[model samples]
Target chain A: MFKVGITSLCLSVLLVTSINASTSGKLLLSGGVNQVEGSAGGGLTPWAFIGGYGTEDEIGANAFITNVKSSDYNMVSTGFVVGFYNRFEFSFAHQSFDTRDVGATLGLGQGYELKQNVFGAKVRLFGDGILEQGNLFPQISFGLQYKKHEQGRVVKSYGAKDDSGIDFYLNATKVILSESLLMNLTLRATKANQIGIMGFGGDRKNNYELMPEFSIGYLFTRKFIAGFEYRFKPNNLGVATEDDWLDVFGTYAFNKNFALTIAYAYLGNIVLKDKQSSLYTSLQVGF
Target chain B: MFKKYTVCLLLLISCASTDKLSTYHDFGEKKGIEKVVDDLFVYLLKDERTKESFQRLNLDKTKEGLSNFICVTLEGPCKYEGQSMKRAHKGQEITERQFYGMVENMQKAMNKNNIPQRAQNKLLGKLAAMHKDIIGN
Candidate 1:
């Protein structure tokens, strides 16, 4: 089912791009890069801006592949996102987590992989994050992500209550052109453990908890941006303590069609490992 | 050490005064504005995305009006005698893409004219306020 959905999504993007849409209007790097969950945003969190270079009269789409590797683990995420009329965005991402030596220590075998799929939808509520520099009002958006894990039985055995969950978030973003700064705040409510890669809920907590994510970026030039992101996570499982995520990242847009992002992320703890630091990199291509 | 601190303080004061210069001065005043306007016209005409809309207008008058408008926006001494944004774009049927395409041209022009990024942002901030009046009318 997931394969079919992804195939259709790719087909639709091709179908739409073959039409009369031309990409020549939006400012350089105004369209945010694809986030971890395929939403248009920073490395870790979604921002209010819809993905792509499409203005109000056009459709835009992006495809991205990202990899994060640490001493104990490796993760790969790839996805596509489409924006419609600058009002709505739909995205899909698939993540595969490889537990290297840690999996063997836990008796699961070396290179045990945990995979999950994320489907997201977002709507612009109001305001213009960019262009409206005359006011303090930020562009607001509401979004939701539904995640399903492939290792349902294994996660349940590890004290997770469910293998799937939903996350709802409200995002606010603003770009102060005069100061060359961009700020974003997102409040997400979810019951996912480790962003649903280890399944949803757990023996310790079954109720949804609200988490906050924030990012601040400075535009060094029209082509380059550097920023920091902090994402608070909920600790729901009794087996291991989950930790918040933080990253310092930089993005350089080669042009409207391609962008490269690299980040040094400190992922506090994932299951048995503590103090996991990783290098995260992503490449985005779009119209 | 005390003498060095005093000298540094004096230099800081002078730098503050330079920073206080208005965006118009940063733009190199009238000649700079004219150069930017001329380059802007060249880009708008050469670009396929914006050439059609610009081709229907009078090039010389449009250039003069844009220069005056930008001058006024940057708080220069010039007086603008052109039509209001709403009036000038009354039936142009400009889409959001076209509006941004023009902004792109202006940015390229400003870059070619050696305007500082901070000054360019101030100008863009002022002009962005006119977006509502110019788009989708």
Candidate 2:
């Protein structure tokens, strides 16, 4: 499985290198960075923008790698996304969660890693978020993500009802050019526990919970933008409490094909740890 | 939460200084606008996405019209003797991509003309409102 993921990522990189100069449409920083789940968005949540520089007449794709590190845990996520004619988007991501010392305490061995694969699809419903500056309506989209955990039996023994789950979401986004600001709000219905890292549903809840996520950004320049995001989470696992996530981020576009994002994120509590604050970084290369 | 953000945004827009005179001066008034218009055409004609659309245009008339339009948008003392956006772009079949191509060209021109970010945004804010009429009517 790991080998497959690596090979696909390599192919994605090659795709980017070969096609970047030919693909151009969306403005700089308009597509947003690759979120943890591999969608086009902020570091922690998905935004309504499709996933690349593609215009309505063009097809665009990109590959990204992200890392988040805290005191007791580290996470690395890699993915590729394709945007079709700026209307529909398809994405795939592989995530690895390192338990570090906490793995030893749980008898799961030191530096134990949990792996998950996410596949996502999104379709634009209506509205032009960027160009239609005269209107108040935002660009909206509907999306779904299917996630599969590698260690199904291990998570089930810890009270997870399933190791795989689906998440449905609606996103609204607007770019108020007058203020050089961008705003996005996403509503998601999910049954996953800790984003399906530890498992899906648990003893506390088996039904899906609706959560809200928000991102607000100010464009300081055509090449630079800074923002804030908050994502609500569902605590489906009774054994460990889950908390909401928030981050303050800034992304700088080195050019049309390369962008770097850095953020300070608060993941609240994860499993046995509390007040998990960490540094998050991501690099995106696309057309 | 969305409602609160809307209210905040409205407040910010209202509180922003709307001194058009200062903004116009930031662009060095009429002379600066002409320079920007000239540079704008250079970029627009060079960009592959927009070059064909503008290749047949009457360069001098378009430049004068654009300069006048921008001057009036900045609330300067110029009278725009040009056609309305709807009429000007009618039957042109412009795509969203082409529209954005023009926007980027305008940005490049503004940067070259030493226009401040705030002034540029103010100008774009007004022009962006006309996109509905300019794009694929």
Candidate 3:
């Protein structure tokens, strides 16, 4: 039932967003791609750009579906993003993570799935990465994400503090057009365990902690971009050691309305498993 | 966290590569710039992207002024001091889309003239910084 609703919603958005490219908005590549947390950015870091083509006057939107497969698990995410006047953004994502063999090892049945819903909002604060061109003022933004992780009992049994939480972040992005390079620095405060898949907080550390995320991208051409992202994670749970996340991704924008990305992700450790390297892919439609 | 800060500092330092534009003078000399100016005008006149903006302009005079302006901007021998972008674009509420259209046509012209991406981006960098002054209400 949930899948059907999301499918219809995605289809409706795709149908409605074929709107003409005649609006006053950014170019095809300016908006960036959707991150894991339903923000416009690289795979792991949320940059300062308000997602989509919306200018200071026009409204624009984007939708994304992502799949990630690792040695011990597989996950799928679907999200919708709305950019208002290129100044503020609202986004929603539903993520389902399947623990293939690992679930059975943890005394759960095989192929157990953990579900999460994330809602986020971001506001651009200052600077223009592109228009400023060579200047030093990077684009900056502030954002927050509320995450609800289902299966609270399962997480609490493992000594988690909460099943839901909010994440706050600030991102600074700069695009050096002459060299075709883009960079992002983000500071995030959170108490989530395994990015809220294993639930939020823990008995070991029940307070919010600060971590840094980094992303760097290079545009090989107007239509293609290659990038890397690293997200730092805090160790809070005695359930299993959590590792930092890293990914290298490449995106190709077919046009203003369609884009695709492929990536290699390293999650480090999870639930007695170590060094979980995986393949990640996402398909996005934006206008 | 300290490692992250160090890496960010390195990236910030690298962002100051603005001086790179001044070093590549051999790519387009005064003679080459004259031809580029001509080709740019031709492309603007014929290219579908920016042809609309060039329709009402005087091509010959535009060619001379643009050529001289670029020559001096690139530290070449020619001397051309045109009106500021705001003054020249006054009364015309040029959109950013139209500005980019013109830049794309110029890029095609530069590509055809074999002006390398480094030099091409250098030129576009200077022009892009004039976005606010050129695009107005």
Candidate 4:
């Protein structure tokens, strides 16, 4: 509890500092949809979709909502992000995982659910679009995330606890074909914490795992863009092991002030043992 | 496959190394305003500010237009359909010093390109006619 309080305080301070550092100029707003397949990292089953909006340039702010579905469970998540000087960004997300009819079969009655919260911060050490030429490398950013989980007693009986841990990652992005094509490659590492709803286990030693991701996009015109992303993660949960996923997406800019994105993901099941797949979609809007 | 990929890669690499415009275009035609403008560009490259401005321009298209404009202005066999100097440069706040610096650079570029002084003077005379519109009092 005290740890959570301290984390919240740190996030507040960081946000305040970033806001003050922002120089008044022009502001840009953007939004997009993201989908995830398979049980990437945590054990929340193999399905989910995320939608979000962001304001950027000197200062930044973003908000998102996510939903995941499985044979016996379902989860919904909401997240927020803010940044300053385009150098540092902070984010917060909360998730609710529900154990449907399976809860009754397990003698816990129906409508049981688990909840998890995540807080993250990212800082850019080098790279800028305005400062660098086309021949130079793109921007790189380093980030950290802390997650905590909680659940109802019936769900807790399955050995769930309020677990907390940290994760770190590095991301690189570039606009290779300026006005036509854009590409991004991200490499991330995180301590194996429980999947969002499942608490981090007390027995396993916290280990760093690499999560590499790639995205390629083409802008058909100033108003439309299509892209895809692939991500890899480790199986941290004992319930079901998961594999990587591929996401295909498209975005349309309504005008200078509004845009929308949609995506479909093919999840590759969990535990490498069972082959389960799912689809995900998201909608985003921004100034 | 490796050989094919290597050949493609070399093609792209060579394309990257090639200049955006040919030297002949930079030097302008053998006799006319194209020659004069080429001279001016060479001269302008010497001054830091004018050079910076020139570098900022989209070199390929701008150079083409300049070549034609100079030829037409020098009584050569060409018509310049682009915007006049004054109308084109309005709101840019270009100063007399900057203009003169540009002219001197043009002279130098002509000399470097082997254009004779007589031809340089002939082109300069026509360039002078647009000063009123370009400088705007």
Candidate 5:
């Protein structure tokens, strides 16, 4: 109950902050993890993910919808974003996870679904594209993400009942290569309860996990890019776990206005209990 | 490897010959003016201080007005109806340091874009003539 109250208070604060930040500008869509930085589809361009738009002088906004599908389950997520003074961004995302077979195994029912909402904000403390000192390094950004999990069922059988918690993450990202051939790196730490469908159940201790993400891409021509990213995450869900997953992805742009991305991910098993892996797809449009 | 080298060598020779056109005839052609102005634009876009200052200006509109400005200033067939360079830039608080910075940027841009050094120097000579009218120093 105390944890739930704390989560609600934090969410309220995030909402107020987002409302105050709306005057700055809407959030802009970012390229995905395939680009080695943040988002998979539109994240590599300046101010693509960490909010804002480009640098400290422009304002940008973005919206996105993504779907992840596996053999037994599926998840759909949508988000709103805004950037201010080109240095800060505030965002909100709601993710719904559908468990297709929980009813048959547990006698609860079939087609059980759960939802997790994540509220996040990021600030670019330093770096600028206008100050192009070298091609080896470009910009750096810091960000925080807060997530809440809501269970869809009340039978208290499939997993934790009324599972809701918060995870805080700090991330740093940089572009190691530029223009024609680009590369990016990101390191993040989180304290969330559950990673995906399985709620954080073991010991209930705040664990700091290291997530290192990398992406390398080539601009086949001027308006198109083909790239991939490998992201490492901890598989521990309070029980037993295995290795992380590798997201292999690609993207294509139709000009400055529209783009599409497709990715195949291999989610390693956790505790030798269940095997989880899936394919993800996203579409993005911008002005 | 030898064939590639021979091909590169021949390409260099042909390029050098094409660039040897007489200065008098070249100066009057569209290519010459374009070459000079593009070089100048490149330099102006490079300097951090100049770039910051220039971003505040209506460069897209200013660029559109450049043809007329150049035609009249360089004794071409057209007469420039736009404001003089000094008058247009007046009170913008631009200093000699900033002007030179812009010129340096142009130099770098020219080199990066592979514009020949001779063409760059010729364009610089024209810009040098305008310094007195622009900087008032």
Candidate 6:
């Protein structure tokens, strides 16, 4: 896990080395940092802005490394993203979930782990979150993410229905410019259990569910932002009850190319651990 | 079911959003706005991305117009008697970068003028609505 995070950062640094001259761009922090799934937006809900540092007529790329640690477990997620013409985006993210003692207790092993890869794409459907001062409609985006979990044997032993699948979502982001407020609402259809850490389905059911996620932020400056996020997860596995998640976070862009983020999250549950709260942090470099 | 959905929708709509005009006016009185406007031009003139567009600009008129614009936009006791926002930048070929650059300068000016973050953001929020109109490209 440690090596994975280091490699993610190294790759991001390599990605940022090739810089393309930029044109006009979105407000700082408005394009959003890389979400856990490697999509652009809040720490959870993806925003409408295209990934990377590009504006409308230019091209840009970015890389991010994130780590979340708690008393019960730890996780590392990292990925790279490319934005084309500020209208479309493509991204790839890798995540490692370490079960620690819980895996041993669950009869798996002392150091069992679950790893997954997520590939995502998004398009700006319509509206400009920053410009709609007079309009009620917010900027909207449609996105799809395909998630595949490794360690299929462990998931199968736990009664998972599948090891790979896709999650579809539509996001609406609005900037109440006068109020200096940023808001996002995401509607997702998914069936992964514990985000596929424990597998896809269980005795409860084997079907997809429509869920809503949201984030609201306030810009302290052109370079700093503070916000809150909420995401509703599907409880496809019945062995352990799943809970919705929420977090309070802040992000600061040192410049256009690098940023630092910190957050305290209430992750609800993680596999067998209940009230799985944690401290989350990530570094992002974009061009 | 329909009534429940309507109520939720209305709640969301209300959640979508502010303070009244007078509270906003306190960010800067007329004198404060003048200083912020001056500081804004200074930064704009210094910014490489935006300096070119402002080179041939008229200083006095721009300052006077911007001060009034800020005041009136905040519903203060002043009227923006200048040309419309669109007409003022008609042929500048203003790119998105320049537009955002201008906003950055404005924020710096507000910060230098000792404007509180709350007031500065409120002012910015008011200006953000004009993003579409400000960009000529």
In TM-score terms, which candidate is top?
2
C-alpha local distance difference test of each model: 0.87, 0.88, 0.81, 0.50, 0.50, 0.81
Put down candidate 1 lDDT per residue, B50-69, tens digits, no spaces. Answer: 89988989999998888888
For model 6, name the residue pairs that clash.
A24-B97, A177-B125, A178-B125, A178-B126
DockQ scores of the candidates: 0.64, 0.57, 0.37, 0.03, 0.06, 0.46
Candidate 4 docking DockQ: 0.03
Q: Rank the candidates by TM-score, best first.
A: 2, 1, 6, 3, 5, 4
The candidate that wins on lDDT is 2
Give lDDT tens digits, candidate 6, residues B1-137.
Answer: 99999999998877554335543455558888998888888888988988998888798988999899998877778888899888888877888777878888887888798887767776777777777667873
Docking class of 6: acceptable
> Where's the lowest-lDDT run of ten residues in candidate 6 chain B?
B15-24
Whichever of 1 and 6 has more DockQ, that candidate is 1
Residue A91 of model 6: what lDDT? 94
TM-score of chain A of 6: 0.94
User: How displaced is residue B73 in candidate 3, in Å?
Assistant: 3.6
Worst 10 residues of 1 chain A by lDDT: A1-10
lDDT of 2 by residue, B13-118 (tens): 8767546488899999999999999999999999998999889989999999999999998899999989999999999998888988998999999999889886
The native-contact fractions of the candidates, in order shown, are 0.60, 0.60, 0.44, 0.00, 0.00, 0.71
Interface RMSD of 4: 18.6
Please give the TM-score that candidate 5 achieves against the real structure: 0.55
* Ranking of candidates on lDDT, top first: 2, 1, 3, 6, 4, 5
Interface RMSD of each: 1.4, 1.4, 2.3, 18.6, 13.6, 2.3
Best by DockQ: 1
- Model 3 C-alpha lDDT per residue in residues B41-94, reported as the tens digit of each score: 877777554677678888887788888777766666777877776888888877
Please write out the lDDT profile of model 5 over residues B1-137, one tens digit for every residue. Answer: 99999999999989766633333233444444555556666556664556766666676566546655654444455556788777877767655446555655555655555554445444444554455456522
Comparing 1 and 3 on lDDT, the stronger one: 1
lDDT of 2 by residue, A181-257 (tens): 88999999999887889889898889998999999998888889999999999987877899999999999998778
Candidate 3 interface RMSD after superposing interface residues? 2.3
